[model samples]
Target: MKPSSFLSLARFGLKTILFRKTDPILGTIIVTDRCNLKCRHCSVNNITSVLYPYAQIRDEMHKLYDMGVRILFFCGGETFLWRDGDRNLRDLVTEAKDMGFLIVNVVTNGTFPIDLPEADLILLSLDGARERHDLVRGPTFDVIMENVQNATADNICFYMAINRLNKDAVREVCILARETKNVRAVSFNFHTPYPDTRELALSKEEKKACCAVIADMMKEGAPVFNLKSAFPYLIENSFPTPCRQCVVMENGRLSVCGRCIDVPGLCAECGYFFVAEYTLLFRGKPKVVFEMLRTYLKYV
Candidate 1:
């Protein structure tokens, strides 16, 4: 297997195994509902709540950290769009770091320029190349590229959700990510058919084809983040994941989402690929471990 940080973690996994028995190691915190763009597949436009202040978010982080959460991800409609009177996303990252969190993650839509707040990982939600991407996002690929080009740091990467619209261009996106000036690596995910947004989800056949391409790219040592063994779980939908690591905090409150909490019968339809990836890690899949380590090394 390729040498990676996760290999080192695997060496210490025996020691850390005791911790997983007691508490969640990672969690997602939606610091704000504020967003600048209204992507058709997102629920950001439906949100009518105001952005919460930094103090409240900081308090939430403290509580989670006290609960043994080692990794914190700042997700949002667009986390970079979040702001208080003077503080910004970078401030949030700095605070999370000060609280002794192992890593801080951000998921953004690549609209605004991210100037401050270095994160352990910044997953930029990209659709596809200009023409296809313009259909999902606005005709602002130039601006997005500008932001990405200017965001020439070691703590950021790209995540392109494979959908019917962009499925055919998956390879192109992957190549672009590796060849792009500022992009570090590309992670792939399938679109979730949320309440009002089902059109973006890929078909079973399409997903399989995309996975085949991804697996090939991975075999070729392309810098793409994918769980080697767990990728099949995405194709067949037979993967088992213990989502004990995450407790989503949305709009200043705990929300497990109806899909994960109320009607778990529909959890099989969930689009978060990280779930299967984590399961593969717990299973000690070497390639999966390598992928996870590669991710940490790139971001951390």
Candidate 2:
């Protein structure tokens, strides 16, 4: 809505129109699969189980950058767990920035506290209020809370995954985000049931209910990080869907389709929010365009 954001929208529009073949728009790199906490909703099966070497990580970034990627998100089975020499996640951010990435992002579980990379954003995977959070993610709520508060000086985002256990805590979490200093915004996602975690998946009805609540909160000025077009996908359980080409892993394995999708046929009930967001954007929704621009401007 502001002039600077408007200019950002213009820039995004022009670049998207002109740079069709330059590079992938977003690249998610997982540094490791070893996690400290065995979350009930996560399947630890068939992970690479090793930290990717620092050299390989550098080379991979170069490859993605040469292809024209401007955004890279550092993902992990616990990215903070990954280590190479004295290098850590923060180092990855510094290096990625040097490589000319427009912005770098990190997603972490918040178990092991460490200084983060100078990334444009850091998304802490928070599920709910303390009790519910502890139930779903183990007794690490205090730790995550402490770390999140400590990391406020940096631009950081909180990602809350709504499930049956944490559904009641939505309002509280929203208030927490709003009241807390150094908290940029909060994004809500429904639980995506990977093989060993199907029970954590919310029912279709529950998903609708949560989406309605979130929509109401947005109208009241509660800061939520969801595109306007993508909002409906969360609400109605029906909308345009995107085909994810592939997600490359640290071990050089490309988990294209079957790998990312939970095995034994639970993909239908899966709730990865980005699928819908990307779908609506690629479908050319005007609101999605504006939301993307707003996010980019927040960083630029």
Candidate 3:
């Protein structure tokens, strides 16, 4: 990260903490809900198969910028599948950078070619090692890995969403993150039960065990991107919900946190690690703040 960008984020964090602001600093725009693969644990994919037009997406980006958002994330059902005539996901990312977003990130399943070098971070979903991952997301693990190996940029981060199906493969993902050529680090999020996917949620004991494994992997020099200090909060779901520091815009609707916040009881069952980290940091947790700084410097 550039010094100016890092300073900007630090300033935002400080202001948010001191003033106890509920406004958002980071904003996620769902480019489209259309996806190619149907993962068993996903509830938001292909609901309507609608792709927002370029003009509409551009307008949304500006709207977010006007609302004090500096960091931008372009998410999707499958970001790569989004297309407005000849334009693709890369165009949106470039436009976000030009729109003064300090860091523009994209979250994809890594099924398509990894060619967006303009993105600050390309979060590739790699649920687990081959067999286990294929169980939930189908038999595309090897293809995604091959795409990662052939990626044009070195900004890829292995994003694993741990659930009952792939909980044991967290260590394998850490090892892959450590060994993969263009990959940066591996980050984990426990499965958030979104109605239909309730069966995939891990038990409290299972979550604790997974966190222990992740912590041990980090101690052993694995490139685990998640803050080990935030593990307990994630397992217990004790952190505050709807972290007002982040927002999501989808299909012209602005929402605090993400779409999950609109779900009936999902907020209390939230398992997203970043949400916990941000909530704890803004609430003036010194350890979480220090760990966030260290992790950002190391990975970003």
Candidate 4:
């Protein structure tokens, strides 16, 4: 992260914390919902399979920028699959940076070639060890690792969503992130237990066990890109819901916190670590603020 970008974000954090502001500092633009892999735990893929156009996405970028979203994420069905005419996902990322987004990230399942070197972080999903990940996301673990090995830049971060099938493999992923060539760190979220994937949701005891393992990994010098300060709140689900500092824009519509905001009763059980981190930080939690600075500076 550049010093200027860091300073600007710090200013936003200060103002938000001081005033209890509801404005968003982070925004996610869902470029398309047409994903190639249908994971067992995902319900957001391929509903319409529409890859939104470049012009419309550009307009949405401007809208998010105008709304004070400095941290931008390009998400998708499969972000790499998006192309309008001759332009690809790389174009959208470069465009976002050129449009003055301080930090731009692209999320992918790592099923395709990765060439987005300009992105601040390429969040690639690597759910678990080969057997467990293949079970959840199909037989693509080796392919993802191969792509990671051959990636053009060292900006990849493994993104893992832990559930019943993959809960035991946390240390496996932490070790991989530490040793992997192009990977920077690993980020985690517990399964959110959407209506269809309720069976995969972890019990509170299970969540506590996961957090304990993550903390142990952090102590052992594994590059886990999350705050240990928020672990307690996350395990208990006591953090605020619908983080006001984050927003999501899909197609032309806007949603707060996440795309699943509309699902009834989902906020109370939110498993997204970011939502807990940002909400607690903006609500003036001193530990969350301090640890956020340390964690982000170290990994992002």
My TM-score estimates for the predictions, one after another, are 0.87, 0.86, 0.99, 0.99
Per-residue C-alpha lDDT of model 4 across residues 87-202, encoded as one tens digit per residue? 99999999999999999999999999888899999999998989999999999999999999999999999999999999999999999999999999999999998999999999
Clashes of 4: 1
**Pairs in clash, predicted candidate 3:** none
lDDT of 1 by residue, 1-300 (tens): 224534544554443444444245567888666677776566554376467778888888987888777678888767877789899888998988888776678888888886644676788877788888777777867788888888757455778877777787777777777778767778887876765667777778888899888878767666786666676788877766445545667655664322244434446766667877765565556777777776656535
lDDT of 3 by residue, 222-264 (tens): 9877787888888899999988989999999999998888789
The top-ranked prediction according to TM-score is 4
Residue pairs in candidate 1 whose N, alpha carbon or C atoms collide under 3 angstroms: 90-117
Better of 2 and 3 by TM-score: 3
- 2 or 3, which is superior by lDDT? 3
lDDT of each: 0.71, 0.70, 0.92, 0.94
- Which is superior by lDDT, 1 or 3? 3
Ranked by TM-score, top first: 4, 3, 1, 2
Better of 3 and 4 by lDDT: 4
Superposed model 1: Cα runs more than 4 Å off: 1-22, 44-46, 255-264, 283-287
RMSD over all Cα atoms, model 2: 3.5
- Scanning candidate 4 in windows of ten residues, the lowest lDDT window is 16-25
Q: Please give the ranking of all candidate structures by lDDT, highest first, separated by commas.
A: 4, 3, 1, 2
